[model samples]
Target: MTTDYNQIANQYKKAKEQPWRTRTELYSMMNLIGDLTGKSVIDVACGEGWLTRELRKAGASEVVGVDISEEMIELARRQEAREPLGIEYRVEDARATESAQQFDISVSNWLLVYAHDREELGVMCRGLANRIKPGGRFVTLITNPALYTWQSHPPDYRKYGIEAQLPESAYEGAPVALTVHLEDQSIVIENYYMPIDAHESALRDAGFRDVAFHNMTLAPDPQVGDEGDYWDHWLKYPFFIMIDGIKA
Candidate 1:
């Protein structure tokens, strides 16, 4: 049940070579968080800092990108050196991140679903809430449980029940690994497929106010029309969800 940051780092390092959806997803997340001009942001589960770099480019004054993977941090550092922007990358667990620094906005893309359960997810949400200034925002992008339930392979209704779908894959070839949670040991991480209502309820329980959910459709970049048709269909029936709220 240990969170293998190394495995995640390795996966993300090879992510850039994949198709355009990766970039499209990141862009979609950025859009959900809105303009970043002159704001201090914390990117939780930041992976190799791709989104952090994008945030800087979008005019965020400062960004702290934190991930659980040391190897990912190393790669992120290396990438940052090539295009020096005022972004800082750190290897830290999302559930236990403790920094004196507060932020204007806290964002987690594809992170919440990986938490062990509602308890662990709530802990992370509360931690992020504590790290933001009043009136600041917390925005997250997660795999839509409904979409996973509808499209997952084998259509195994027993494990996940007919009401929910278990995530078996993240991309075309990448098989999603199964994880088991242990109370005293490091919990194996996997997506917690919950409906949108459950997600909003959990966020509210974590002390966030005014929770809202959005269905984001990734638009095909006119520049990459047919090459990005898969993304077009994806957007039409997006497999992801965007949620945002403010700290009370």
Candidate 2:
């Protein structure tokens, strides 16, 4: 099922506040991104622009956030209006995204999994590759293909505020349902599962090289007490993963 992010924009934004998002997901992605001083960045599937604003604040010379949902873009714009970060927000589909200016780096939180099949995934990869300058970098978070069949049953990550279930007869491009549980409510997000090799091949076919998959690493946080014991399962088998490649 195609998720109407427009209808769940507010809930999804609130989901970003979940502890695991910052302590692990964002931390892992940012570590892979490294420095951004004076660089230009394009954030595809930017959603509410939380990461987009962070990119600008990280000293990016220019930042543009693109999302397929108008409601998501509107929320991002409203946040920009209040803070005046000089970021640009656009409503566009990742498969069709064509930035006016190629960027030094392109980042996405959860774009690739939207592709229902290899063909659509290739289109999304090519679009991202085109928006990045030659030699630039591409970083993204995606459903961990490694975990798709690593366990007989899908993981129950409620301790981290998210739940994902894989079908008993899972196959390539199978739909996986993920629910993000906030303090007060929960939001369901639909994503597709593709194997690790499939993702690497698509990136390479789209002009990327040195494609790498990074495991989730937890940053020490006083807020999340006893990080090691609390995040053991996640460190061993994360629900999502961070991947990066250099545009060739």
Among the numbered candidates, top TM-score falls to: 2
Worst lDDT window (10 residues) for model 1? 156-165
Task: Give per-residue CA lDDT, model 1, range 1-248, as digits (tens).
Answer: 34466865655455444343344467667778888898999898888887778888888998999988888889889988998897899878777746688899988887877655566667777777777888899998886655544444433322211122244543321223433222222223345555566667667876789998887745445676576333455555555678899988
Residue 202 in candidate 2 has what lDDT?
A: 94
Per-candidate TM vs. native?
A: 0.78, 0.96
Off by over 4 Å in 1: 1-3, 20-23, 148-189, 226-229
Writing each residue's lDDT as its tens digit, candidate 2 over 85-202 gives 9999998878874667799999988999988888888999999998999999999989887665665367668788888877777678898999888888788889998888889999
Q: Candidate 1's error at 99, in angstroms?
A: 2.9
| Candidate 2 residue pairs in clash (backbone atoms < 3 Å) | none
